[model samples]
Target: MDFSLSDEQRAIQDMAAKFAEREIAPHVAAYDREERFPLEIYAKMGPLGLTGGVIPEKFGGTGMDHVTYALVIMELARHCPALAGAASWASGVAGVSVLRFGSEELKQKYLVPLAQGKVPAAIALTEPHTGSDVASMRTRVIRTDEGYILRGNKIWVSMIKSCGWMIAFGTLDPALGRKGVCAFVVEPQWPGVTTVPFKNKVGFRPMETGEVAFDDVHVPASHLIGQEGEGFRVAMCSVENGRLGVAARSCGMLRGCLEEALDYIPSRQTFGEPIGNRQLIQSKITDMVVWHETARLLTLKLASLKDQGHRARQEASMAKMYASDVLMRGAEHAMQIHGAYACSDDFAVGRFWRDAKFMQVIEGTNEIHRWLIAEFALGYRR
Candidate 1:
């Protein structure tokens, strides 16, 4: 299959790269240190229609294909992964749920404003009780004449501290496994909704992750996305698509680490000789390159499948798993090449190190992804 970018793809990538260089790379250092969400950066992205890249024209989006979206993600991620994280959160919260699944009214009410970047959005799925067992979520939504009352807590929802809406998933009936789960669009200012911001992450600090508590939060029936007993499927679908975005991001991080390590090794001195001249450093760099290409190759393969209207579950998992590992190991090598300088923000490698570790945790932990890959290969059907 041809992996070369079309003219349109190149244009989008150029635009994303320009935005990242001017808007993200300069301010990322201070933002990362402060652990703050970059609203100005999001505002710049909104004008590019970045917030609506994959939604249809009717849904107020550019309606671009998935591969183009993935390219934009990669270009932006290369400059600053935190900015990429914010864009990723906004894209999924606005496009996938409403443009793909929500009713007309839900799209108008939430997705429209979200696409314009007047407000941001996030997905709240993981709870204190639920990890990879999405069907076992303990959050409950009790029906009412008006709508539903939500009672549960979601953990590690990123960038919602300033978002205007949350696409939340919960169970109408827990005993029903996947079938009982349902999805809803809940506004941030809803009467019983409360959020406590989390700070001091090892990496990706600019994304602003946190906890969301739905203490008898009341939502209207009209806000239900798709229908009752359909939440789990929608959540899984959103996450599956979302993983492609993560793969794009991980590749960007891996490439950054690899480039940094390569650039440093040749210039670094060891015993009056270039350390990169040594065989050991060459071997480490070679290993990093291998993993990085593996990540990129898997990402492109899954992206091709997605464009062909095929399921890309296994491909996405493999890309995420390998790309994250590459980023982590490459970051380690980057730090080693720079020695103690990598520990400081003085070098980009330190931030990449922390951010790469954070990537390993988000999207789905490597542990979870491994289980999925193993299960698929073993022909285990759930």
Candidate 2:
């Protein structure tokens, strides 16, 4: 019945808020304009323990709980969702898999550096031909005496060049379907591993997304995470946790939309009076407020459920689906309230609007999430 953030969680939230204001807010516009990743920001974050919020102290992390981790992401995304997205990708989504299933040697090699933010990491699960269809991935990993040879192409991996390692999934035999897949922590600089940047993205521009191709990339047996044939489970674990992260980011965007509208309305004059005086303008502001609070609660609920060691697949889907839809709709309403000003780059509303749409597609598409929720409700899926 406790709905309030614990004292420790509040402290972490405040710290992240301060970090966002001082580090993220000022440079966000320039970074987005140039489509540049803020490497220096993450460097600063590493020293502040922001990079290791979910990592255990033994692994050089803060050992923070998932709820507190969600709070930190909320603050970071409030200023810049792209920055938050990149940070979550490195610290939580990619690092969590290694912590949960990687061997000690693999953790020392990859997880430790990731916890310290000495380098970045990414998960490569999306292929050019396969997105939602995990069983149909064309990427293949063949057995080799040395270890395994990875040969495949991964598209839309965020910050590919910047990451030191990739937690990639490939199938041993496509015929075996999901059971045949395996997860490997492959070094990005290995021979035959090449990447090409994707430019002109509609949103999330501050993060450098790219396509990576592995032509007989060599991976040692030590690099494998979890047991063989466990890649599907490993990827799903990361993804399930990742749903909460995306929800947190969506909550932040929703809050940002509300704050922007509130700030803009009073200063904007129409018909010899401030727009805030108009009932129609007030309605938009009220809607933004509602979405912000609703999404925030759903995100925290999902995080709390996760912290309790409960099965949260259905809850995570609901949170991600509802929050993403709220963000997209909230952004549009905020844009409409801004009138013609929203179209200009001089304001952040346009950027927020574009990023909100992208949020709906990442982590998992809203369509997939809808199906998942429907299945759960109908007792057709566990």
Candidate 3:
């Protein structure tokens, strides 16, 4: 029942927390207002050795471990979930995939710069027609003389505007179902690649969601990750790791919302007395603490399983579901304590409310995750 973090994990968390307060807190609201990606920050993070924390040193990364990475993500997200979303998409999701599957040349070309924060990458699996049902994607890639010709549309691509490379998935042979899908690295400078910007998202505005269209975009066979027809496995692997990142982010959001509510309760006055002294406010704050702790515990459990090299598919789903649900609950309670002021931009609670609502929708919606968990609990699907 010991519940202490290792020295490395604690150091990573503390560094992330301090960096977020110093670098992220000041511009978060402005970034949300402008709906612009924080493009210049990575240049600064490169010299600070923050970008490549978990990547192996061979690939020009510090090569720590999963739990440390998850902890760092949580600490950063507590300050600016938007910035965290963008960076995690690159350094967390897409970055992890490259480390797992890329060829040595691919590693030298893409992974090194990515880990060093010199280049940004994106995972391009979700399309306009498919999200959680990723196996049904319609994008097609055909074998050519030297490589593959890519043609499809990927929508809701987080950080597309900022990414220099994309790890994209498409069906090479449709008859094999999910087995036919293959993934390849496509540079943004490649011919026939175009991007359409998204604006005014309900939350995570500075992350820069967009649609990427591949019109006869050609990539060399050397860019293929592992082998033909292996994209589905690669995608699933990245997502299993990604579930940990999402759970961590959601848990941090809950903690941030609770932190705000606790601080405001005592300092804010109602009925000529501090709100913290009132029993009603105290009850609301208590519920927030409960939700925050529940989410944090789930995050830690998932991280431990991942660190042990277990598959973690079911554990990841459970952690993502519970943590995201708790994030929503904490946001709701935080807003309730503020009354009317919660709806205003002047207070940070409003942003947390919107962000938490989106968390339930993103990273495989809670509905889909429940089905996944149920299949395992039932001893296999009926």
Give the winner by TM-score.
2
Q: Quick one: ranking by TM-score, best first?
A: 2, 1, 3
Score candidate 1 by lDDT.
0.80
Q: Write the per-residue lDDT of candidate 1 for residues 1-382, one digit (tens) a residue.
A: 7888999888888888888888888887888899988887888787787766666666666667777877777877877886676566545644576766788888887887776666778788889877677789989989988999999999888767888888888898889989998889998788988888787877778776789999999898988888799887677666656787788888888788888787777667979999888888888789888888888888878777887887778888888888888888888887887887787786778988888897787788999999999999998934
Candidate 3 lDDT by residue in tens digits, 259-288: 888777766887798988888888878887
User: The CA-based lDDT of model 2 is what?
Assistant: 0.86
TM-score for each of the candidates: 0.95, 0.97, 0.95
- Flag clash pairs in model 3: none
- lDDT of every model, 2 decimals: 0.80, 0.86, 0.80
Off by over 4 Å in 2: none
Q: Write down the worst ten-residue block by lDDT for model 1.
A: 86-95
Cα error, residue 336 of model 1, in Å, equals 1.3
lDDT of 3 at 49: 56
RMSD of 3: 1.9
